[model samples]
Target: MPDITHSIDIVIPSYRLEKDYILRIIRLSKPEKWVFKYYIVVDNPNVIVDEEIARLAASGDITLLINPVNLGASTSRNKGLEAGSGEWILFLDDDIKADERLLHNYVHAITKWPDEIGFIGLVKLPPPPTAFARALIINGSMMIFGIAEEAESFAWGATANTMVKREAVGAIRFSTDYPKSGGGEDVDFFLNVRDSNGGKDYKTLKEAVVYHPWWNEGRPSFKRSFRYGVGNSYLGQFLPKYTYYDFPNTPEALFLMLLAFPIVIFIAPVYLGSWGQLFIGFGLVEVIATLFQAAKRKAPLSAAVAYYVVRLKLAYETGLLWGNIARFRFAGIGARFEYKGRKHGNGFFQFNTYKIVKWVLYALFIYGVFL
Candidate 1:
């Protein structure tokens, strides 16, 4: 780390967090050579804090703000940010503690990266051991809480363990206009920053890692994954930033999925005159590739495990379908208005004149050709 000197306000918005988790974060966040202040905003004031944690609050080592009502992380975080006075505000999840040198990496990255960089993303270390956790990790989605890989110009990052330049984040705040249960306000909050802030990007300090106690909470892991899938539609619905993360774990997988739907229909007749043998070839290659991917995993995977992973994948799909329907139930009505994005056909509700034609072609190609 360079000889950099800047104050950081560690903001934690808590809701029913464990005492041990709270203490661990409070301890690990206090870097030896750094000037930092810690603020823990209790979303529900009635949620009891242990004696040691309360003492720390009384001693001024940590500041505790109480929200009269439980407004969830997004709203509580905004309150913490408002109270924090520092050059940088490091937003951390109440349940997660950081790497020993996490703060150092964030400070170093801020000093090192270009000024256009608005925030530094941190890696969420391998989650706790559980069947659901393992499945969620293996069946990955970019929207999974506190997940980041590779230091790139990626704008979306979990606020669970990230540092943001306080000045760069002007009027932008986590959107409380979303569902209390459906998440993505954290990810969308930063994406909105990139959109309005002269195209500012966020980078990862890969070593700035935190341990997540995955699937330890009361909510079933599958339910959480499903909720995340629904929550994802809110990104495109509100901000117009296409932060829609795909359900397929990889780009190849995504392409194969899209291709499979049509390509399978394109085949399935006599292999000669009407149907494509090419589709069969593609399917064989895809199966081999998928098996190869599963084999390459560090842990030996079994057939049962693979099936469970497939189930998790479907959970995401279901969530996306349900979420979009719920979010855009009135989109057709909104399309009629002469608004910023609607009137000129640039909006999401554009009249796709060729839409039905494309589907009709698929239907005709499938039945007329195959049968």
Candidate 2:
């Protein structure tokens, strides 16, 4: 007989309101030592709730809240949080499939780390069904949750499979400043929680796993990537101390600048002359060097994937640049942020390498133009 001193409210905000997925979570076996309640916030007001889901709600198995209007994800989550009274809150995406041991593992972790105010679970991805999906994995875009699987502690974790103690998260709700389509709200929320809790990082629990399906049937979606970029750009303003501006720190920025070389040469060939060839050559080198690094890292790479990667990178960076422009931060075009004191997980290597390459390219360009 396990102790029942605490309760957990599982909060899910969904526009799709997939009945089967919701049922699967409701049907998951409850943890012995913890009580559970389901709080499903329907972001779509027009969609009819499934009969089975309605019945569950009527029977008290699930508390369903239908928004009168389309209130995006962050606001929907806040609505769910307001209705729940559990000591801990477990947030899950409507599309995710939870493991049988999901609740059990969280309970065990709670017991083991009583002082922890939050916990991050592993988000496992199913094997890619297409080469494009595989490329996403290889490029690290599909593995956004992979960090939680490896790191023992992290600055923040995705809400798709994260749990937090209610007391520690007091007054710290997901920020609506991000794009309504969704992006950096999760990081902002968790980072705020950490800050409010005296800098206590969230604990990562590999045993708690949820499988997330690839978006758009595993095909590349530049729109989604662009939106994510736009959302992430706001993080710098939301948390300035952890983020800073730099020149050409991102592959997207480098690729974009490199792409501009041809246009510049085309518009004013007289001014650049043969010097434009050097810029073009440098761009080619950048592409080839990236491919080489990918291959060296054992990442899946092919002509098709290379093309997709470039297109996606360009789309994301363009959105990021647009975001910076929207915020009127023209001076901080290439902003970067640190995670656990490291920039993008491998700060020292990635930051310095990009910096050196960018400056070298600039020096060469200057030399060709002037000398």
Candidate 3:
């Protein structure tokens, strides 16, 4: 049996919120005994706690750490970890609501594991959305974990809904160098842990269940897309093994059949029926691959089709953009682990002049190659 005496601390980094909602979730989803503390790191110190929070303030189980400025997620989380007093830390996004049994399940699951495990989290999904809410989910990523098993590998998406043993994270901190709050921080953290101890000891755990909050919003602008591209570009350098494993054929495979498909009726094509055939075949392959993944997840078929179209185009365009600007700089937010005296750098890159040039080249590349 695993040791049960060590304490667990749950850290929630929040911005502005309706205190009542936060209170409701905590009261309804009571945690287990191993949990020694609950810490909420807020951007504003003057923000009022909900009535219930004030009532429970004297219990000594909860602590609120106030920050003078919005230091972004990576920094704020590190601050929480510093103030926390437990052997294990549970990190939760502010917007999420726990399943009634989430905290208990986490305690049960984690206690069964060995000390070397680096991280763990519950299964999660985007909350059901109204038609209006669907808009917001467009560019947002959703995380869902399956049955409890030792993770064979590690990845960035795991951070949004997971737990990390205090010792595993004792030496690695979140990277602040990321241009934006939501960019490459997770990837940097995961890579650091994997590379630590000479890459011989890195582990992740997923045994509990949790839900991710989702809301419909607007489509991403070009600026947002480019920033995301730059973040991935930076991550590509660190975890060269896993960054772009999904795309094997790249520009070659996509460009070969582009113009030949739709122009078969009118324009004089050079390749006769070959390019047209490849275009249809590859397009079908793309659609099938995407739809299969979506179906397995029980996502709507129509939405799957739309997602395939949008994502394929975006991938092709972004690939060309990255190919052009092959440079990355570590200049943005950097996170420091106060207790551990460790830090990680999130890289930053400019998105102005190159952004326009990238789109135009991508458009031309698509037009000339695909038609």
Candidate 4:
């Protein structure tokens, strides 16, 4: 029986409104020193409402809003925001497994730092169950929320677990321009809040933890990555200052060029005879070098992992290229965009030895692939 000083609205947008999952979250959330309300927005209008969920809604334990038609996650979140009447709005994903202390920690942080506009909670991934999951973890695909956990303050955090002040989010809504599959809307929403408040005051609260399961059952999925890339194209349109031409710089761009090199040799054999073969040989050597390094590191599945990594990376970039083409931004077909507001650490050299070595290898690989 702690004194309640503030109110929080926990907003979750879900397409698959799982009753037991939502009930688990509600049961685990301990709003020790604050009053909180759950706002569940169902994005799929066709989803049948659960009897228990409807009963909870009727009992006022939660506010359930079923969309009249299918809407994207962003629009669903906007609907939740419109319905809530709390001082803080905590955005969460329906799939996440909430920690028992999730709401309690947030309430403590909010009380301790009343002036802060937002706080990002830590979203952790369970141990990788498969080789592909391990690869994704190592390659940084599964570490999006983990990265924010290491930071004291960050530019944007995934809506999977984040709390924002209602005043700071006044009139700011998640962008509906992204693809229906969802991608850049979370980033766009936070960036908009940051811009409106004119500060990077969102602090990271590592104590509030949530677990997000890997998609596709810990297996590799190109479609999900490709959709993310397509969604990223909208970021460039919304925030052009961070976007730049990616040609001749990124490994993805270099890989595309390498794939097109044979056409160049075939078209102009006289101009590029043996040189083309030599160039391709160098690329082969780069691949061999990578494998050798992996062997030295004692990673048995390095070859398979590397193959999947390159394949997924290419898929993402291709989707980005197609997205740019769809938007008629021909010049930005090979564009590089950095929507993540701030970077942790001082410079590349300041990174730990492992990171430095990884970056050096990447640079060498890029150079070799470009030739």
Highest TM-score: give the candidate number.
Answer: 2
| Candidate 4 minimal-lDDT segment of 10 residues | 343-352
Better of 2 and 4 by lDDT: 2
Regions more than 4 Å wrong, model 3: 1-4, 28-35, 44-48, 54-59, 126-140, 143-157, 197-207, 217-230, 238-371
Cα shift from native, residue 233, model 3 (Å): 3.0
Clashes of 4: 0
Model 3 lDDT on a 0 to 1 scale = 0.53
Query: What is candidate 4's lDDT per residue for 71-168, written digit by digit as tens?
Result: 88888999999898899999999998998888888888987998898998899988877677766655455555885657788778879999999999
lDDT of 2: 0.79
Model 3 agreement with the true structure over 48-111: per-residue lDDT tens digits: 6776676666676578777887687778778888887688777777666667776676666566
Question: Which residue pairs overlap in candidate 1's backbone?
Answer: none
**Model 1 CA lDDT for position 208:** 75
Global lDDT scores for all candidate models: 0.61, 0.79, 0.53, 0.75
Candidate 4 stretches with Cα past 4 Å from truth are: 1-4, 248-301, 342-371
**What range of 10 consecutive residues in model 3 has the weakest lDDT sum?**
332-341
- What candidate 1 gets wrong by more than 4 Å, as runs, is 1-5, 29-34, 114-116, 127-131, 142-148, 217-220, 241-301, 327-370
Tens-place lDDT digits, model 1, residues 153-226: 46666777777777778888988876677476776777666667665567656667876655454223567767
